[model samples]
Target: MKCIIVNDDSEMRKTIGKLIGHSRGMKLLSVFNSTSEAALFLRDNCVDLVFFDIQMYDVKNLEFIQNISERTFVIYIPEFSPFVNTTKKPQLEQLSESTIAKRFKKGVDEARIFLKLIKKEKPDILDDYFVI
Candidate 1:
């Protein structure tokens, strides 16, 4: 899966980039320090996954999420406890900072399954795969 990281923290970006680089079937496409930069990239490019910092600027507006395509999945990285409402949005998920490595791996695994189901055109089971 092609992926990008958008975070103001350089260390966090590097960390997540490395994880993506090391993960099988995953590619690190690019990294952005701001939401506007990522938005500009997304305007023309479509990636399979995005690792977005929830505390980043413009995140509160939620315009960024609305701008992306439904096929794209997002994993929100929070500096603290995440409180975003993920209710009907199966494409969106939050990664706990305390267990980032484990959660990230799980998210990637689930995304892979989701993509496979999408490729198989199994819409019925898609809803069952994502709890929230």
Candidate 2:
């Protein structure tokens, strides 16, 4: 899917962009430091997804998202970033299959509900992501 990263913080933008690049199902189109730049780009482009920062300068990210075509899917990364340290890796790795399955199911259920709303309206944008 074609995607863009919009974040005021350059480092945050890079981090999210790298994650998107590593994802097997996404295509990173471009990265923007401000909402206006991204808004202008979207005026004439058909982007499938946008990795948007929940907190952006001056312009409200949510409002900016609303102005765009509803056909676009946005995965909002809140400013309160989750600090996942190396210490958590071992514990996470020890998760049982059922535990993993439960988490996956919860994510899928939320996505299904969101998609249902979109399908009733745009019916075109179907993207999913885990909000940490």
Candidate 3:
């Protein structure tokens, strides 16, 4: 899957990009520190998934995603994001890993649970693969 990371912190963006890059079926297309840059890029391009930070230095995450509602899947990675409303959004899944190590070295059980939740919530992302 083609993916991008949007965060003001360059280190955070790289960390997240590495995780996505190392994933089995995911590709890190690009990482941007500004939402405006990401937004402009998304306007004329297509991405399979967007991993966005809720609190960017100069942008509102929700507003940016709202402006790009063109069949792209979004996964919010925020410190204080609310999951209470995630269940109501189609193909939305809450990722709780707060650190690169936690995401990259997650245990099999945790990975299994995360994968199951993602598959159940966003089956279209995995429909072509027999397993992920």
* TM-score of each candidate structure, all chains considered together: 0.75, 0.62, 0.58
TM-score, model 2 to reference: 0.62
Instruction: Let me know the TM-score candidate 1 reaches against the reference structure.
Output: 0.75
Q: lDDT of each model, Cα atoms only?
A: 0.74, 0.63, 0.61
Sliding window of 10 residues with minimal summed lDDT for model 3: 87-96
Q: Write down the lDDT that model 2 would get.
A: 0.63
Task: Write the residue-wise lDDT of candidate 2 on 1-132 in tens digits.
Answer: 677888877766766666566555667888998898898899888886776777676446666877866555566755543334343423333445455445434533454555466767644444443343
What overall lDDT, based on C-alpha atoms, would model 1 receive against the true structure?
A: 0.74
RMSD of 3: 9.9
Steric collisions counted per model: 0, 0, 0
Once superposed on the true structure, which residue ranges of model 3 sit more than 4 Å away at CA?
79-132
- The residue pairs in collision within model 3 are none
Error of 1 at 90 (Å): 29
Q: For candidate 1, lDDT tens digit of each residue in 1-132?
A: 988998877767877887788799898888988778888898888798888887776643388877866677778776543344455422222544446677778878877877777778876864565422
Residue 9, candidate 2: alpha-carbon lDDT = 73
The alpha-carbon deviation from the true structure for residue 14 of candidate 3, after best TM-score superposition, in angstroms, is: 1.5
